[model samples]
Target: MASESSSSSSSSPASPASSSSFLTEPSPPHSPSLDATTSSNIDIPVLISGAGPTGLMAGLLLAKMGIRSRIIERDMAPTPDSRAVGTHARTIEILKLTDKAVYEEVGSQSWRSESMRFYFGNSLVADIKPKPSNDSEFHVPWMLAQTETVKILTDAYEKTGMGKVERGWELLDTKVVEQEQEQVEHQQAEDGTTQDVKTTTRTTSWVETTMRRAIEGTNKRKGESVVLGTVDMAGEDEDKDYEVKVVRSEYLIASDGGRSTVRHRLNIPFPGRTRDYNFILFDGHVETDLSTSHITFINGDNRHSVGMFPIRDNRVRMMLDDGTLTQEQFNAREPKTPTKEYFEKLLEETLGTLKLKVLSYNWLTYYRVNERRAAEFTHKRRIFLAGDSAHCHSPAGGQGMNTGLQDSYNLAWKIALVLNGTAPQSLLDSYNEERIPIADEIIKFSAKTLDNGVYQGWLSSNMKRMMLSIVPFLVRYLPNGRSRPPFSMLGLRYHENSVNKAHKSQHYPVTGPASIGQRAPDDILVPFTAPADTSVPRSEYLAELEEDLTDQPIPTRLYELLAFPGVFHILVFAADRLAKEKDFDCCLVKDVDHYQRIWSSRWPGLRGVLESNATSEAMMCKKMKSTPQFMVHVISSATPSSFESDPNETTTTALADREAGFGKVYIDCEGGRLHERYGFAGVSTKKAGGGIVVLRPDTHIGFRVSNVESAAWVEVDEYFGSILVN
Candidate 1:
């Protein structure tokens, strides 16, 4: 998909006669199905407005969680314009977890930045190189056009067996409705006949949306703006020209850009100040004396600045800010649609002594910067505002699309669990609690970056440039040594809530420092069971196993093991073996047993626990599914062979295997390196030495306890009980 559209002023006007012709026309190819557009309504699990990156991601996530969704877009095709040009590390991580193949495809086509170069009057000021991400393989932002991102997400969503995006559809009106429903139950009699047992009345809440699509060969308004309060006959004719469709959905996700009609319809107050900064942006091929390998920011006379960000090949995204407009003109600023030649001259003027020439161009856009966020992200617990609908800010850090993608990542799972009856509706509150703060942070960070970008003879701007020059040296002194910048979004953490618990709840001193609400840190681990190769000799395989696996060149990461969708993963850090001990329980076997039994029995129907009396061998032969709510993995500092106790003393417990009810076993065989990373370095062989870490569906550290005692296990159960349904 092309990420550039024609100038904003190129929209064609419409006549009244064309608008009323819809009455006699057939449904167009992009219109919704006839049944869907008729008087009768179509029911869906989730309805998404706008098929942009955020909406498409929400659809994909819901599908991964076993829920279906319908995405509707007003545009007949994906917008040629790309409002966002890159995705940060956090967004890429979410995409990788959602679908690895899609992540690889996007990453392969994106351009990775090497560094950022700042210049004042053609004199280089700062050349800052990006630091690698400590927690993820994707360290920097992957510079890809937003149109390409939407295309990839759309393809992934369709492959989920969910329906495709319903194009040429506009949300006409939407509101929450309550209706009384009648449900009947039947019972089987002794004669093997069905009998009506009971009838019940229940009140259900749903979002009822009225959708509209202009009938082809009619006055569809083209791209002309239509005022609702106008008295023109053409407006009246256009009003009733489109086909009306009714949609009933349990939830609605509005990702429909900054001019969100849904947000306006809901009367949600969008509060923020619009800056006086106006700029013209475009993507094109450029021949220049300066290097294109890095993102370059140039400041010229009269406060003019130009930013050149390399895309692919020789093309670059040029953002030129003249900074010449007066306060009053900026206050009443409208979009400026100048020709390609105009932008070329402006770029040369901003470049000063630096020579550059534009050989070809894609598209250009002119607008002032506006930083705004909706007062509320959710309404009535049924309607949600995501992406640009929730917040909009300057694209200083290339954070517009990345932040929106993370918003969907945070929202989709909560909605899925609630709809599946596994979690309570109150869980939905955390979406707002967790994401609004992140949005605020992004808004503030981007505003600061924009304000301090160009020199313009401002002391503050020059000072900031000087500070940026030494960022590489300054980061080395900070904790974690600046693997990723804060704008890359790896440093954001959620505040303590029902979902993100505080460490003080646990009396044990297990979790070192404090990371309960932060991203679950990553480390290397040796799997207890290695990948098998039949061609290899048994002796060679045995030899390889005997060697320290963690010392091998390529080690498995903890994130790879927690990549399962919509499930909570519990990591039990069981420390080393004690030769004096008779059994290999590591003082955690009883705790693990109680955790397994309670999880398997508590929410039988809700957890999707498959009841089986068959032996472990039979279960393995049948390939039975694991419990949906929880997955447990035990990581021991001891090697697999260490679990075999001395037979001469006593054989009290079974070996650490699936049959022994210890979940899947993994080895932290790096001299407890992985254990120490989680603050279990010099643990005693008793119960207090090890701890439990719970990874939420989004891979954030939801909860942690110091010891594997019954009291700790009970607290873990209570954490789940607070958010999950009865």
Candidate 2:
């Protein structure tokens, strides 16, 4: 389980070979039965190659979607290197919805900052800070190393009970093969006897992968948990040879980093330019006069920019251009900057009068930056290239890993629905349609940033300084003024994706300016429900309800319900009680009836509807997760005691109770804060204020349905019908 055990010989060539000999040998402490490597030729619906942050993320997401996958990594242990350090806010929100605990787990070790400090050769240029107020408490991006991010995702995937990552295994080759499977069915006869009645056979295309691993399988990979009866390969080895194994899967996702062997074999063209400068990248402890509280950049005449960002344990990640030789000298088979003295020279030059020194290093390397992307992300709709395999760029602002994380998020659910018969094959096309453009944009922006960062000119440097000086003032005083959206990733949207109806150019009028094809905005909700039996004013008990906080179940937030996995969320903003008429609304139950018919007509096997307003007596018992494909939540203007009692019927009249809250209950609150936010402030209460918001699994608002029973809902059917299975 030690990191050293799985390190590549290329990574630490000076180390003794005997040190890794034990990697293939079995330890005495482990039982021989546990030590034996069992191989089975099994068919998997989804297979992922590479177990880095991207691959691990894809596996975790698929598991949450109720699909199983096998993840493979070439290395025998986890690496300690950290390529990504900034986890952006958009990624944070995405993680929150994927697994509620992941956001906090990674957040605990991550550092957050609202501003950054800049110095031009020891002289302060300006402090660039974002204007505060109004987003979530955890609005800022967190700095966590990529290794730690991988650990968190891997742990979460293991706990899902769907699949495991096969470490110490390499994907040697993959071939498309046609496979046949025979299925059996049984029926009961009228004689009260069971009959083995029917049989069906089918042939399908599968990707057969040839995998290799050490035959003896020496040590368990780092962060590996104890599987009830598995061997911990942590001791010495008697064998050095490897064993070849084969596994079959319907689809293959290649997330094998920038230098992908899969991409190599496929002969895919990785088009882009590689930079000439050799840059020193390191993570280590430093002794410096500059503060480490925020992102600090050392600039010198725009020709040299050295980035220094603080990390955990008082360590820092430093990057500086290695300018010792000419471009021609380096191209003539010259060695990269080898000595630690070169790094010291960089620090001395950038820091100028300030005292800054690197005392020790966790990792250090010199490399040329490559800005490249694969020409295509898919092959035959069965193979996918994700993360580094799809695109690569300078690690400016740590955008590489963050972009890759989004790549997986964009693909997982679409594939999951397809494999399990919940969606159609056509849905998969949107992956390339949507993500490739984002990848293209990130590449363009990162490449430009790198170029402009080193731009040397009379007008540019002075302009940059002037802009930085005034940013804080504008951010502080301007109304609705704040940091740019790109940094927070809130600006990311599918401008013209096949699945999203609205173009990115269109603007949404809702509060938060929520837009279609963009991340859905969040809002608060006040829980509400009228007593099942009587029409009584809530003011009579409203004060008592607030006094005993635990006794009264207050309203929940919009994000809370979206966290429930694998369903489309429909938010119905029902009309509250009429001011003068003072009658409770009936549109909610009617909307429920509309959904019931839709479910019965098209989706009998799927659970999708969650009604928050008036629940029929038959459906008040099913749990949220068990409710299949649709979730319905209501926001009404009425309170618990505002309904008329129905004494004639035996149905329970218990609103606001736990059972009544199955789909969740919410009140519009005094002055109708939420009602106004969704554009239903003052309206006739004679019927439901009919509107349905369709939210995707990723929480992007796909489109809106104006009427639950009109042809608009039929468009909803056509939408899902286009992607979802019949």
Candidate 3:
């Protein structure tokens, strides 16, 4: 990382330059001679604006791509407050891709546990259980304070060795000067004689050069280069060829927190309402009998919710709502001033007299639930907004910091592409298309969550009162099932316009939210195969295949076997091989044979496609015949219940028998439900070759195809073609 001294002299802003006058005619002037030496000295691109996280991230991406950028920050010193804390799995994955060691060190050591509890007055209601894992669609949520997250990211940025964040420099104004093209004018030309000649004539002309610039400044910081001279905008030397003036960049990303200056300047409307509930958060040391756990959310009569988690060693962080104290009161409360008696009282009121003591208080902050999102995340070509700058909501979901970091993650790659001249500028439009719907959904879900937490009293409390009044027996028997709403961080899915096509569906039947294009879940996948080989099992083969593809070894193959490139997959296992063969063209026997021959011929290439160790005797035989570029496996058997370890054991008997040879047979196994789990309900049992299965790359089903001959290949070809880049 580039380290510079904080001591540096300040530079004054230059005078405002005249704006380009394109709408009016240019004044006639004498052309001045330009010197080649001065003209050649100008840099094509240079520093232009503030050096906040957004700008710095952009600069880092650009630098990685070998582009030059200078970042200027208005802040004299970096703030130490823990503004945002949460980091999403996606962001972690992205950062891991960039710098594995740094990402792991920062992410792994952050938070320890998470749990949620409910309360009704002084009584404990119930502790909420995390949603059961359906598949590897989501992972457990992790928490980290915001200040630490920023420090890590900033450190990574400085380490890139491209540009340094020139703090204390602010953007004052911008003007366009000598743009590539100004305007084109067309006019009618006069004829020799008005009545004698009736010939039409035309003339075209170009407008003069446009120039613009404004003034800004930078504060002195130790150990940094500082310019002492005042930059004068009006004092332009005539020898310069290209107009030398400061101009706005092609794009501006507003990651300036919730109170975004860029969003305000753009006049964008933030649409949403703030909730009345307030929260108090503190970072400090505490000791208690309760061993460290995931997260503790205590909700009861005092109507308070506290989240306590380990940060480092004995240091812990806690978030709780003291309903009695307003934002002002909470802010005014001094650290270490609140006595142990006061903390005990607060805990008794909030957590039903929990036995815990506060050793030290580091930081205390008050926050209100403000659920708001901008109507538009982008404006024109000049400005784009993200993170708290674009959306804000209750910290209950812990989405504030996570969402912002993801915003930068999503936008950074796109910006890098545009700046590097790889992707067209139009690609930027997809940012809004993909992210807006997500923000809107989060807002809706958060609102519902808040409502559920705050409004359940009317019915539950009254019922409890009535039950207690009638008989204590009935009241005691009634299940105390009040639990926190399912706030799994993994629950959030980018079903719409997500690059992952497999997770496009609303939900995954087997694993709940394992939609198409969503992240595959981590699970212990049991494997089954026909013609079971004692040497290698189906699970081993699938595991190898996954490892070969991703490099990272997955413990289980949670996704379907057949997946389209960049799409989801839905694998269907038929009970019998004849039934599977029947789904092909039985009527067109020749065509079926020819296609089978072709598949057999291409089976060898399939070896390359297998993830890892996904080789079986049957697969080996298939590979011997021909290598397919990509092929998924499925076992078929007839005896639904009798079929156990090996399906191929009875394959000879089934295929030789006349009735069972061409008929469909149901197979009973734990894995048989895999089809139903993935929403493959409409199978055509009447005809042998009538059932069709659809697949997405991430192993989610998009749609199924049935009763088709060569059309299946066509569909597969088309789907893969759209996603894979060769």
Cα lDDT tens digits, model 2, 61-161, are: 88877778899897777778766888887788778778866777998889886567877766887777755423332356788788889989999888888
> Per-residue CA lDDT of candidate 3, range 291-329, in tens?
445455455455555666556555566666555445456
Summing lDDT over every window of 10 consecutive residues in candidate 2, give the lowest-scoring window: 30-39
Report lDDT (Cα) of residue 194, candidate 3.
34
Supply candidate 2's per-residue lDDT for 494: 73
- Backbone N/Cα/C clashes per model: 2, 18, 70
For every model shown, what is its TM-score relative to the native structure? 0.81, 0.77, 0.56
Model 2 spans > 4 angstroms off: 1-42, 132-137, 178-203, 216-240, 323-329, 478-484, 502-512, 529-537, 542-556, 575-584, 600-627, 636-663, 667-690, 707-715
Q: Scored by Cα lDDT, where does model 2 land?
A: 0.62
| Candidate of highest lDDT | 1
RMSD of each: 8.4, 9.8, 12.8
Q: How many backbone clashes does candidate 1 have?
A: 2
The model with the greater lDDT, 1 or 2, is: 1
* Residue 101, model 3, lDDT: 45
The better candidate by TM-score, 2 or 3, is: 2
Worst 10 residues of 1 by lDDT: 1-10
